[model samples]
Target chain A: MINPINIGSIDDIDEGEAKVIPSDETGTGEDIAVFHAEDGNFYALNDNCTHETASLADGWIEGTEVECPIHAAKFCLKKGTALCMPATQDARTHKVEVSGNDLLLYPNVPAEPVEA
Target chain B: MSDCTSHTSEANASIGRMSRPEAFTQNIDVSTLVDSDGGLIDRSIYTETSIYAQEQRRIFARSWLFLAHTSQFKKPGDFFTTFMGEDPIIVTMDKTKTIRAYLNSCRHRGVRLCRADAGATKMFTCTYHGWSFDLAGALQSVPNEKAYPEDFDRKQWGLIEVPNVQSYKGLIFGNWDKDAQSLEENLGDMRYYMDAMLDRDPEGTEVMGGVMKWTLEGNWKLAAEQFATDWYHVNMSHASALMVLSPTGRGPKAEIAATPGRQFGSENGHGAGFPTHPKSRFDARPVHEYYDYEALRERLGDAAVEGPMTTGHATVFPNFSYLPVNGSIRVWHPKGPDKMEVWAWVLVDKSMPDEVKDAQRLYNLRTFGPSGIFEADDGENWSEIQAISHGFVTNNVPLNFQMGIGSERNDGTYPGQTSELYSDAAGRAFYRHWSKQMNTPAWHERTEQA
Candidate 1:
């Protein structure tokens, strides 16, 4: 089982901006990007864009969505839905939770499903 | 009535131009074309122009045609443009909160008045000569009115109103024949089955969005009959779709001949087939999961819940058909002998949550929309039938509908004739009703099974 890693205080990442956790600490080989979205909530997805070799962490965050840096493709940060073009597949998502003042990331664990 | 625009009377003008012609239908006999009891049907019923022309007058003109739903008109001035057979119609709610329909032509030059499919309008103005009509089809104004003779009465120039207009459970229907039966009388025992989709909740039902229309090269009856009857086709026709949906080969296995459900033929030619399917097979999750069984039971008795309620296709006589499970209602309009225009709408309980309504809409689109998988299969079959029947030799051949022919029965449990799910009794019954309407010239002379 993968343990929950403390990603420090919620104040560490600004709203509408994202930060990346290196693959070595994640132990899953893939880098994880943590987003503090415009909805004032924390979300995590695999750092690499599904369309090409680009970091989603560096893309622009627009209202709970992140535009990929290289191709301009967009994805829904909450459910990792591929919102628009050059990308047809969704990026892998990891569960994230805010407990008190700290942000905890459960590596390799899937988040609650998109509301039906 | 004198036509104001035309000076010469058409009857007096045609006196020397032409002689009276024999009836066009003198050659084609409807009796030999369809032997519903015998299970034999002629191919020309699906491909002949003469027979189709007869249908426009005999079937479309006289029957209670489903035009629109009540939810479409939230307030006054809300109007929807549709067709009864080939003629265009406008259905609108006036300021009185009363619904009315009119023949969608300007009284001035016979030009189509309502160009848009649906919109809010207090009045319809003709783009040709600027003739204006109110929501209730009254002629409010006519351009150059004083230029004509003093006998040019504006009151006589109103939009032609439909003879009969009525609504049953928020589903509106219009009839051109004034002396024909009432909407409730025409619906007959079919109303029992219709309640399966419409009356499940006291909260009422509403059509989701504007209709999705598309043309297909097929006879309208082919589509209608498929809905009314033909459960036998699904196990073969939609096998590929079922197979794809069931990657593990554990898909819906509601076998036809052995299933406990029933196929029914109503008193007024409506047909229904409800084949049992396991809940594990597949269903519109938002609709099924959220249904209040106790509420439904309270609103509807055991006869409705346990009776021959439709879980599949159903038709109301001529061409109104709906899928109770898929939540789609459609009308197959006869475009020509070899063509049809399909108008479809998605419906759901008005009380459902927005998310559930959205899910129901998506489910209906994936299952019965113009490009839906099952719809594609049904379309291919209908179009191919029309294509192959064009041959003289092929057209002469009679198709067999002999599956359980003599087995149709009524146990007094349900309202109409019924047989096992796999039987073609309902199809035969539908054709039989079509033949009766075609052969009889007068509505009063026609025989209706009680």
Candidate 2:
């Protein structure tokens, strides 16, 4: 069963900005990073980078991709796919949905089976 | 279990299975140097003279060793002198702009030729016996030609040439084994990491400053393996340096111990590590700040510049290693069983600004140069271990390397075999590959079958 927790209102995050939801709120040991992409959509991923112990919430966000500040590993905010070397594993994406003014987030899940 | 199967085996398994010449396979047994589990390596391999000789024959002679960077020989007649094992070699560019390497010894009396480290020369004339060889390593002139018989062939007396010479990206490598695989084949999956650090920008990279060399009393493998797989030592080995360099004055022990990172193991014994936090000006080090990411992104694309490129340390099996974050590259040249000659060079992007390059050089000097704090710390550790291994009781004991053994699982994330950030998986892999190379009879035995 998926427990959807309300993080904040949609106005809490600015366009193209990212916020780190603490682990306590996400019910996971690792924090969750919520991104308000320039694509006019919301996405969430595990805050810690797979390549290292960096917080993706502290990374640079442009368009729909986030670049880790520590090693520069880029992850797509829309799908949480690792787009290059160094970071070979894609970030685990969290289920997110916006309901009016409320932003609801679910635990991270395996990525959708990539298309052949 | 995520079926942590080794991808390297699928791509490059047959490299060790090829048949070799009977002459090369006559006698050599390195089965004693490595344990059956591939976890513990025999310490005597570091102090035994006989084992060192075997290493020269099987490892150095057969492997694609680093020779010179392509930027070192930009003009015709340019030459750089380096070593393949203990044998001195000179890499030169001939009139045709083809790069070649030759034994730096003259054919006559076996005198050392080309005493200079690097220079543009039309020909190399042996000081002991005036036997001159052109840039192509051909015997162009010989003093007192009248003394020789008319039938004597000067063509046959050219400098002994390295059998294979190849370049990947801008780094040139040479191998003495004629049947050795190409540099690309030897590199395998390691190329991905190399490209991430080296080929990120289209402008390419270049070597800066002359070589800084120093000798240390340590086994070459100690230094090589550490660079390849030892991130666990940083918190303790470099505690004092971090304390001095830390902005908060809180020291790096707790921060480093708590930080999360990944340790990567690859085919052919290559290993690398990445730090959890990125080093930059905001972290109180102006020298660590990279070039403007936006500008680099424009040229290198988002994936190349902004992906797992911040490598804190890495090794290309054997002695070649580097720290991508600081652009410091080194080769742990084996001097003997108990000693190694370290040759390090600073690398920087060709497009970085002068101030940034200067700052970067200063950073390298402060952190990894011969007298640098970290270098001094590592030197002491390696040397003390070598000294301790001289004792019979200690030498017989096996070092522990069982960290994250059965826990290794692949998430289809990185290439090659991998474990946790602070694990001995890479170390085990290094020993495994070392054992394989050492036990491979001889270079000729692994040549392509007729």
Candidate 3:
């Protein structure tokens, strides 16, 4: 269980854009990137790129994927899946919910649970 | 005096050369280490921190350094990033179409201003603090104008500008010292050789898309000297690569012992070595020879193309080096005493057909790119030399440079002190001019034989 932290309104991030949620607020000891995907839905992933030392929040947000700016390794924003070469591991995804106009971020909570 | 000096040096604006490399190091302490007079080079010059720091101050900072080709700056607000001795710089063409180079650091907090390798933008807004600078590097906007003190003047704080910038033909160069001599004066006889590569098509040249960059653990001079003067190593060091390049025949060691070749060193430490035979081609690859010699005969005389000494390797003083065979232009940006970062660009004639241009790109990469065959051979030698310099015993050994020492002559065949086919005359000249520049603190007090 995790406490929901209010991360401004949905209007704070525009379509095809992303905003960085600071590390201290994430409770996971890593920075979180709340991306407003082009699909008109918001998704959250760990900000640090798994390939090299670069912030994923500063990367390009495509339809449902984000490309790492450092080496252009694309990752699936929906499942935080690394979708290209040079990046083998998946990015950690965080749970975020849009309630009316307010965007709520759940710290330390996984967005999806995989099969054991 | 030989006829080469008598005839050429009568009008020779360039001083010390292959024959007499110690032209400017008459009174310097570094001369003892690089005893060009006796043909012995001290090993410490490659690994000493004090000598390396002095090189940064006197050599890289004062010499005319290569910037960027003119093709990258066709538009008004176009810009690109390059380094001047490890100091990042932005070369741009402002609204007036005037070319300029400025330090890449933001004036406000000294953070890097432009992070992109290259792109055109009207304004560069600092990612930190959002301080904006216009195309000419003028401070344009401050995010919070009201928060600043009343006396804070925006005009006073602009991106620091490189003191001098100029171009030779299409090649642009920058200098940190304003008092340094003109690029032409520094280039001297080396320009005559450069014309062979740059003036071939009359359509001029353009760098093929993309730059190839990589790092190696080696002192910068180790590579620069080889490019400028050490073609003698090509047969030995790159023997395996040559075998792969030309399987059966002797390759471009083509009658090397039997052929007539000349090694030349100019006033400002520039050096080149090439065989004088008209048909002596380094790479047997025919696609690289697409230049129309008859069409160029109108601009350049028959002698220029016929005797293609300019077809070989050459280096301009400190670090700018180029090879005509694969059309690779590169600058060895010195990282420290034992490391260098190589930034290379593949240049081609603008009028070349698409396929030929593509072939040039491939050949350029296959031969000299990061993983290139010849590049690998060269890197290993430089790296091994650097690694061995770490030993206290090996560090004190004086390397032999006595190949064709007394053979430097001027028969009026090529240019200044065209020594024997295989010689360290150019290397001696290189270290001589290096010691001279390292010793002279003031630009004006520096003397030339002329």
Identify the candidate with maximal DockQ.
3
lDDT of 2 by residue, B1-450 (tens): 110111010112223343656565344576776763647777887888877887887788888788777778788889989898888999888888888888899888888898898987666778776677877777866656778999978886877788678777777778777667667877876776677667755677788878888999999989998888887887789888777877777675465556665677765878876654444211215544655677656654553343336545788788888887677888888998999999888887777777877877887888888978888999999999998898998988878777767655564655556567677777777778777888775544443442
- Fnat of candidate 2 is 0.00
Error of 2 at B390 (Å): 1.8
DockQ of each: 0.01, 0.01, 0.02
| Candidate whose lDDT is highest | 1
**Model 3 docking category:** incorrect
TM-scores of all predicted structures: 0.73, 0.71, 0.72
Instruction: Give the alpha carbon lDDT tens digit for every residue of B64-120 in model 1.
Output: 898998889989889999999998999888888777888898878888988999987
At residue B215, what lDDT does model 1 achieve?
94
Query: For model 1, which pairs clash?
Result: none
lDDT score of residue B394 within candidate 2: 91
Candidate 2: CAPRI quality band = incorrect
